[model samples]
Target: HFGIVRFPQKKNIVFQELNYQYSFSDWIQWSMKIDSDQKTKEEYDKKIILFPEKKQIRQVDEPWFDMLLHKATIIGGEGRLGRNNVIFTLSLAYYSSGYALETCEYNMIEFNERLHEPLSSAELSKIVRSAYSGNYEAASREFIVELCQEWVAPELKNKDLFIQRKGWWKFKKPREQRKYSHKKEWKEDLVAYLSEKSYISKPYLTLSKKDLASELGMPKRTLDKVLKELKEEHKVFYKVTRGRNGGMVIASVKALFGTIIQVRKEMQQAYVAAITEKFGLTGSFVLNTFKQLAAPYKQPEEVRLFTVDTG
Candidate 1:
């Protein structure tokens, strides 16, 4: 036999159950030893009348209870998801907070320690909430917006921000995740410097690696790397000369011609043809006309004649 009971508490009521089981032999013995007398039968009947029938209660599984347990595990911060794991990271934060679609604010101090740049508290919270609610498209959009602001903003460029640290942007990947190539920028600056000096007919500049690195505000190793790339591309020529003034001489091959010489041979031919056609003259006539036109423009050299007479 089983019975269900509800215990009342100050705040809520708790439901409990009690159960008793009897074997076949015990039931048979009890049945056979039943009272036959009228008084005993009346008492048995009264007892039976006093007790209520037991109702069979089926145990139902509550999925929500299991979900709550899972959520608690995540909220306890048992593990960390990598920055590259965007969806998983957001989901973890979401489930941990009791499946909250949004959080009030992001932990700025934590972010600053990790990413070196603290994102806006409100923006990060909204993005996390959006990702948690399975709005991946919206979450992605918000994430990209923040990433651009942090990574590509003009004011942020050249700043010694910590882009190498992992898990910098929470759900977004770090800048170091992809290899950065500054060869183009370096080459441009180097070329510009060469061009400036070459303008004064100085096609080459000699400087030590350290000095060049200092001028470019980069490490010597980085300068070497950029120079190597520039050399391979044939965009700039450099060589180390040996002497008291031994140093790396960077030459601008393209800048040697300070002005671009545009040959107009075809234009000259066209002009000759037009003059011949318009004047209805032969090639010889055009040639003679050009000679006569140029004669007036020619400056004659002064002639000094000395006469030595024999007496």
Candidate 2:
């Protein structure tokens, strides 16, 4: 709706109009920057949820909320979806005495925690009610509509009613359950399919279960069963999301120097932790390995078996 409002008359630009540079170096550099920005945003977003507040109180979720909102504000410095929606939701939830939003600070925290992620009206309702410790399930959606109407802006207040009126419940189901979970025999087929494609991110290493199942051509339930078998057999490591629901990644163990170590899996963790732990060894080890490998692979001189040089 926002995009439509802003660019109603403007046509979508095509690749030809994008004025893309043709140099490999420029393209690679640009791609890397985009990938880096995307990764940083994802990491920061996760951190916001995990530590919503900064100061920890025994039996109080205040500190976690503070941390989340703070991080959300920092990331949403550009005033994009992350910041505005987070602030709006927290403000609304807090005003409604949502248990999840213990106070204004807590509400702000949750808003930041859920930034940029789409939630169905039902899911939003569940989250709002869950904010409070006390159970308060109403007879109908009237309470939720009123809460939103009172809390959010005039534009956003009626979003719940809009969602319900438009039959948004149909889209609320977990993606994996709705799509995959229907068959059991497609495990190997799914793996083979995923293995064939070179993913922008690592395949089967750290993606969501839904994403992996989609790649595998199996139901999410079926994928779960297969993943369990694989993890038990030490065939692959599916990395689950932390805090909020995260995806799974396939961590294939590699035999290096008689040691069964997950090269990619371990390194990814080390890389993530290194950002927090400057003394961490993961980043250093990978860097050293790259340097060592590059030196040997470099060609000092070129030899021609058949030379046709005219002097």
The global C-alpha lDDT for each of the candidates, from Candidate 1 onward, is 0.43, 0.40
Worst 10 residues of 1 by lDDT: 302-311
For every model shown, the clashing-pair count is 0, 30
lDDT of 2 by residue, 110-219 (tens): 55455554434443443443433243222123333333333333343333233323222234555555653333346456545545542324332456667766766566
Please list all clashing residue pairs in model 1, or write none if there are none: none
Which candidate leads in lDDT? Answer: 1
Could you give candidate 1's per-residue lDDT for residues 103-154 as a string of tens digits? 3123322432254333345434543454444423222222323322333342
Give the best candidate by TM-score: 1
For all predictions, the C-alpha RMSD in Å is: 34.2, 28.9
lDDT of model number 2: 0.40
